[model samples]
Target: MYRDNLYRMEVPSTMPAHAFAPRNLNWNVEQGEAQDLAHGLEKSEAQALVFVSHARPDDERTKALFGFLRRASEVADVMIEKKQQSSWDAIIEALTPTLPLTSSRVLEAKMLAQAMTKVIESEDFARAADIAEIGHFSSKNPSSQPNRWKNSGLIFAIPYKGVDLYPLYALELQNGAKPLPIMEKILGVLQEKDDWQKAFWFASPNSYLKSKAPKDLLKSKPQDVLRAAETEAAGVQHG
Candidate 1:
């Protein structure tokens, strides 16, 4: 009975640090910083947002692959969310007369992708192979809002190597890198054969194999170039 009582007394000592409230810790640490921020605003002090990060300094391979991509995506997502939550009146007030809207949207998407890639491949992120995507996106018949604003991003179940890279590489090789679009048959013919277009599918291996295609055309982004031969063929035939 004495030993049992002693064991019970020791149990609480081994409790994990996380058993305490998380918010309290954050509140204590962040309090000074928040106060400084307010003081800076009052003084109209020059300031730059130093990116405090959770990622470690040593992460390399994962950073290269997913660091920039993840971070950029996160940052962009926050901005997008804020914009979405804004009232229409507030949005109208914030709009710039010289907005090159499409370009901005594209930039945001690119940044998000870059951040993600860095995060995934950075050496500090040691679990390079184990790293999995949390979210993702696809652009088949993408709406302007979702494409520009970005819907939820892709969530990879596994690190992209054997399973993901192989198929992508195989597709690249089969397509002769001209991407998935083989326009030779279609420049004019695709416009004529609307029904024939249905037969072509980018996901089909048979549709992609070819040689002597433009390097630029072959490797053009995946979402695009997926059905170039088919779409153009329909365009020409349908037109």
Candidate 2:
């Protein structure tokens, strides 16, 4: 019961992969569920099963979570349920297999960007459009945002502490677009949250102009990031 004293609120907007205070789900925590949880816990099975959380990266809860999972993975074959917190005990038991340590919060985002070779801003779609895609299209041929922005996708949320949170960004596409398993693709992109320029470089290197990063962007200023976005927008050509 690591409940913090401060009040928490959810960001109000349409985010593809929304992160919020962890909301506990009520279920039997029955034997079947435990087995299922254990099965899904196998990290080696998937490239990575990232946990997108709202917990401050430096929070004690983050450390606790990592420690907890590492311990669990070590004893994955054993039924050492008593050591786990009641809430997570159920999740661990329900896991289907041995899992890898999850990359949480921004770390998850950064790793996902590396895996997918793309980036996600974690902003609402509209904000993403504001900072990333610039310019307009003809009404007869209005441009559509990537599919992930238009819909939600495969994602998992773990308790950052007492709160429920998830990845901020959903996925869209690569520069050299190829279809991904819809859910994995979503998971892949969600992993890329908040590293838009790097994502672009990785996913579709050809889409970016490497010659001159806006000075402000190189300095990691917000306005400069927007400048880079506009530059990207102006450069997009529908062939």
Candidate 3:
């Protein structure tokens, strides 16, 4: 009973002066200095790390804590509820842009976007709707067929301006508009890579193929294209 009582007793709120005072003082001073350095707006660039001292108990408590933070600083609040299932949801919610982008960064982005738009909107790339209309895919949801093909790795799509556009060369126009015969093998070589990387490999000139872009020879010389993809994949692995 005595041992059980001792086990249940609360820890002392204070420690001996010699045991932790020096360490506590040092830690407190360092933490204060870090906060001062991070939050000093007079610096050319400053960033701060803020956190709640304890786990919030409820939605109202969470909201109240964030509200206090917003009042204290120029912060954009993202109130996460207990019921949310994914960590990504909270992160995405926190990152959702609350203001329009401005300055030279915005100008550079706009220029890049215009250049990409010119290429992505060309005849080389077409949306699912266009392919469905031209290829006559036998499905109720014609627009979804290309996405299904992309998911299966029979073909890939590039994302531009919030829309996915498929390369027209990925399909065979002569034979029931099925996926290009060699694409599966090429995609296999570049497996686990993102769409943009795969797209870049197709668009960029390859020295292995005598400086010809892979897409240009995909129909005329599929075996050569496959070799080029293999060589690129090998280089990426080794280099």
Clashes of each: 67, 33, 0
Expressed as tens digits, the lDDT of each residue in 35-84 for candidate 2 is 33444444323233233334554577755765565555445423433333
RMSD per model, one decimal = 23.7, 25.4, 16.6
Q: CA lDDT, every prediction?
A: 0.32, 0.36, 0.66
TM-score of each: 0.14, 0.16, 0.52
User: Who wins the TM-score comparison?
Assistant: 3
Report the lDDT of model 2 for residue 150.
30
List where candidate 3 sits over 4 angstroms from the true fold. Answer: 1-118
What is the per-residue lDDT of model 1 for residues 91-165, given as tens digits with 9 covering 90 to 100?
667784765669889998897567545534433222111221211122333222222221222111113333222
Model 3, C-alpha of 54: deviation from truth (Å): 44
Q: Which candidate would rank higher by TM-score, 1 or 3?
A: 3
After superposing candidate 1 on the true structure, give the runs of residues whose Cα lies further than 4 Å from its correct spot: 1-146, 149-200, 211-232, 235-239
